[model samples]
Target: MFSTVYDVIVVGGGHAGAEAAAASANLGAKTLLITMNLQNIAQMSCNPAMGGIAKGQIVREIDALGGYSAIVTDKTAIQFKMLNKSKGPAMWSPRAQSDRMRFSETWRNMLEQTDNLDFYQEMVTGLLFEDDIIIGVKTALGIEIKSKTVIITAGTFLNGLIHIGNKTFGGGRAGESAATGITEDLVKKGFESGRMKTGTPPRVDSRSLDFSKMIEQPGDVNPEKFSYLKTTTALKEQRSCYMSYTSLDVHNLLREGFDRSPMFNGRIKSVGPRYCPSIEDKIDRFASKERHQIFVEPEGWNTIEIYVNGFSTSLPEDVQDKALRKVAGFENVKFLRYGYAIEYDYFPPTQLTKTLETKLITNLYFAGQINGTTGYEEAAAQGLIAGINAALKVQNKAPFVLKRNEAYIGVLIDDLIIKGTEEPYRMFTSRAEYRTLLRQDNADLRLTPMAYKLGLASKERMDRVVEKQEKTDLFVKFLKETSVKPEEINPILEANNSARISQSMKLFKIAARPQLNFNDIQKINSVASFITENNLDNEVIEQTEIHVKYAGYIEKEKNQADKLNRLENVPIPANFNYEKVKSLSIEARQKLTKIQPETISQASRISGVSPSDVSVLLVYMGR
Candidate 1:
């Protein structure tokens, strides 16, 4: 083997690249990670937060699979909140406000410490392809490094262009140079590519704000960390965020810059995230609304810097200052950095397989922003799955595929590989049908054994998981076997706003009521004693509660997933000419032929492929 030939070579050390390199290296692959700037590895380019909604579940899933995102976030996190606490377990997500500087440093430190991982700070300008297969990368300095497999997680850096008002620049990020060569080369290779844009809100000095003028948003009383690793958080001491809103005055000032706005003036033809729109888009879309929420998030414990969320703008800096001043507490705010919009190149993910490997290039894979995803957590989850599959590929092992029923990661990949997003894809709870079985609290329960079998999860982690499962099983049995008399459980039932117990009932039966919870049962001294005697960890206790309470729904979703799985299992041969089937729509035939979906279920979900088209496909497949 050549001196520099590595088992895996990962380019662009952003969130996705960092996780991918770490996972591949941790799985015993001799991996080399290359990036333009090592100092910015894992930087929070947009927000100083780790997760939100379905994104948090992705972070937890990455952790369960032995990826480093959750571990780093937990270490540098300043404020932690479990979002959607009032909702069902399926809806619960753990998010953390992170120290931007510390988060990057933590990732650097972790990468430095990991075995079999090497780092190089340089820009990759091209890939070396021989006989239609990617053999390695060519750096800007004209260095050719060979590797068995290459994972590209370039984030928003590939052919990146920034737009601020009417001004435009060629840079990956603020003060950073954009990567060249790769996009032109890929396009020449017949890869279909498109432009997508995403924007970040400005950062302001927190010292200039008057706290009394804004509403304080506090962290969860008992903030939970993301990793299953035993790490203690300083519970009593927590940071507080403030909430403000954009007033009509602010909107009016922002409108003055509309004529010069890149998004409105047609400078940016790329589609931006619909859920996270620029201030100008909001004003134009919701013209009558008096105000929109603005979250004033702290950058770190020691820094006066704060991220102005929900106030993303691509207006001129002077215009941004004028509008921001109109917000109640930010009247005297000083800008630390101006917000701008970035446009980057991304291959529609349908160009890749469910394993994230490129369909055109053998042993070459893509992950993170390269696949048009938006958030750090989403990128990290993709990185982990990609890394695992890459390592398995090297070992000649069976491909590791997570079903949509098993994880949000699975759903995410399936969606990307099947539907191919035009805009930056983000995670949402509503996207997962089997969400009840994919709760954040039970990520380790759902994935640890698989990780252990893949040799990614540590034996110690597996042992702890097994112990937790045993305890959870025992506790679930207790709930099923133990019964309470009507006199014993009625008061507790009434307190939780549930129907009064009519007679003796099994603990599982009462806990299954939507209003009643296992915590209510725990409050009962007798039941509390039974739980304490089992010596269960809090995670197990929580998981067991969710399992018992949502057993019926979980089972139903599982069955639904199983029914879908039959179609998922029915493989459609690649290169099957949809045009041969005369009954299919011309549009359907073209889309089906282009996407070349591997299964009937996947073909059904693609845009423009209707129910009738799917039926035609099914008959053609002899299903």
Candidate 2:
């Protein structure tokens, strides 16, 4: 029997639940985090790494919004690499290969150290609801703890069914038991749910692979970190990942098991991530290709366990071993664990508000795979938002929602609530219309202020953001004012085969040229002295160069975002009858009524609501 009523109760201690608890407790909420297995807190159940492509941006945004993901990742990272560095700053993303056990331990330590947070290990069997609102949760042991709000980050545990080859069993993961009752309870309480599938590649012993047969993929020479806080430092020592290719012979060997593959044998009824397909799916889909790449990634500095990236399969164990050994470097590959595909329950995210609170169940929120998202960063982002809003609700404060132009988190939640994914939702840079504005380098500049106001981000974070902004502004001003004479810049320009300027050019203009980057610009005496005089770090210089180079694109994207935001400002009445809008398409009306969008902008983004439909909604809003 609990003596105190918690302000927030988080179910399942994965990335999402962990973040939700931290955010709520940090915002002054009396929070309790309950998990079936405390030992698996923030488990990297899939890959032993964090941050990739747009997921990296989400991790940085989570850090800016006062979440523990990036901090923990930095502390446990064995290797660091900034992906897409050859591209523009907008494309640059930070990725780290973490020591698996260390990452989980770091997360647990961070949670335990957080004030106002308590931990409980129990399977939350069902939610305790009063009428249509959440009040608490019931454990499998029949303990009912009271809470003002509940966030379900159950991950892939609800009625989970795992498939390996022709074999199927009830399980959330390899050895983890499936969580029952909660999904059924939710459905009975008027929540709709669906199923989705995701899988992890086999883990092999590193000693079994031949490194000479694969290409070495080393970490970046100048590795960048995920967290914006100065407390975490970059990795000095790094581990190398090896890239090996699977030949046609390997594909043929895998093809021999297509008859037994759960994915191909019609055993998996749900959809999996289209981009991250299993090896069997890949071979079948791209039959013309002779080979596919597989990454041999080290799980930790001390462990010999290797993650076999891009070889996810639900084929027979014998077939998996046979196909794996055919790969260039995996000739003597020994499996630590065979790959598996799991089918789990997920609620249609469209049933939730932008705050991640279910529209049908007051104070009952959803995050992680329960909301149909598939990455740790995505789950953590949703958890941060849900936790902040849940705590703010208890405090009688207005809800916090980020605009799409501000962060990828915003785009992700917006996409889910409006469009609703039929398959597992994964983040990509292309998904963000204003990716240039939402660059990884500017996550703190975009989100830390709002987080600080909510008391989630610390004052130290706020101070750092302020300092970075001030210095970046001053540096940009200096670049604009200082002119580079032909004698001072032409030689450098000529060496790079760029058009030589006859007249004096502003330092900003010279820096903006396509062929010139910060490295190239640093060659100028004035630029070098200005950087040295200001004692500017690489971060500040990086920010300055991006601003100078992408000024036009950034401005254009901002203008477009502004246009959409205007529609966002147009409010729709909560009880507005869509049936009365005769001019609206039947599909639009149905979507509007079902989703009950709060803003014309949100309605515009709905799948069935078109430009014409948005026009009608705007007219109804007196726009």
Candidate 3:
């Protein structure tokens, strides 16, 4: 029997729930985490990987904000890669291939070690609400649990329906049962909900494959980690992944199952991820392409199971096996399980405020797939923000919100709340207009101080950030003050194909050339001695170099961000009635009224609201 009321109750135990529970408890709230299976905590349900492209930047941001995702990732990674190495620092992303089992176990251990947190294994059936305000949850056995605030991070589990070829079943995942009651109850309570579909590739026995026929994809020669914390261990030995291609023969073999494929036969009505489409969908969409790339990734260090990445399907088991055999290195492939598609219930994010709390219900918040978002990184970011805001609400403190220019987390939440997603939302670097200011290398610089003030990020983390900043500033100042003659600089510059300087110039100016780098400049005796005396780390030196190299672009982006922040400062009263404003367009009024945007800037971003509408609202606000 549940008697005492908790400060926060978090539902589901995937990436989002884990962070939510950790954040709420670490911030001094008594939190309870309820899940159907505790052993599957933070399970990498799809791929045994984290941090790709924009997702990588988000993980670092999470780490900087006192979230545990990046630390866990570093602890369990089997391979590390910094993607887009050829591109600028703003575009570089750190990714890792994790040992799936270790990833989950690490998360479980972390949750158990956290203070003010309790875990319960139960399927939350419904919410406990009083007059449109959520107070707690109800389990399947009808036991009532009370809480001041509740965060539902139920990922791909609510009313989940799985499809394998023509066969269908009620399940959240391959071996897990579907969760019910909550989605139905929420809909009855006037919350808008819809269905979304996502799928995973089949797992195959690694020994059955021919490695010689596939191309090897190795980890970075010099790898970097995700965590800003110093306690995490760096990877010493990394496993290699392989690349194979699906040929025309494989496509022809797959098309034979079109009649029974769940996707094509109309069994699945919901939309899947647009960017990471199923193989069958890919073949159909790009008929002109000769072959599709398949990434063969290992599941774990000890396990022989391999994930057939890029081969997601809902075709019959026989069709899946036969088609996989046609791939270059999978001539004798054996499947551990056939790939399947699952459709689950999600609420439109527009129904929620920027803090992730529902507009219709007080103390009720939604994160992860429940908010129509895809990817573990996206889910984790939402959970941290929601958890932080939930605790602040309980303390009667102002809600903590991040600006778009500050963190990718801000951009994600803003996009969801402002322009509600029709398809599952995934983050991309292109989404951030001021990406140069939002680079992965500088996530700690952007968010740690704010997080430290919130009591989520610790003093130690803040101190580390301060130390790094000070060292970087001194290094930059040194470069600007020190003059290097042509005799000292020409040898390095000429070797790097940079034009030789005619006279003595500041080292900062020469380092800014496209071909020259900090490492090359450090060859100067005085510069190397300065670095050694300061005991500066590679990251600090690198940060200083990037700042000087991209100074122009960085300042330009900052000015633009400042201009936008002006409109952001003009707050629109929460109780403002758009209908009373006679000059507003009908569509703008309707959208503005429905969204109830918190600021003039948010109102400007809404689809139907125009610049003229924003001007009218600004004038109405007496700006």
User: How well does each candidate superpose onto the true structure, as a TM-score?
Assistant: 0.97, 0.99, 0.99
Across 478-541, the per-residue lDDT of candidate 2 in tens digits comes to: 9999998998889899988899999998888888888877898999998899889988998899
The CA root-mean-square deviation of candidate 1, after full C-alpha superposition on the true structure, stands at 1.7
Preferred candidate (lDDT higher): 1 or 2:
2
Clashes of each: 0, 0, 0
Candidate 3 clashing pairs, residues 3+ apart or interchain: none
In order, candidate lDDTs are: 0.89, 0.92, 0.94
Global fold similarity of model 3 (TM-score): 0.99
Instruction: Report the number of the highest-lDDT candidate.
Output: 3
Can you write out model 1's per-residue Cα lDDT over 95-146, one digit (the tens) per residue?
9998899999999998999999988889999998986788899987788999
Lowest-sum lDDT 10-residue window in model 2: 614-623
Off by over 4 Å in 1: 231-236
Best-first order by TM-score:
3, 2, 1
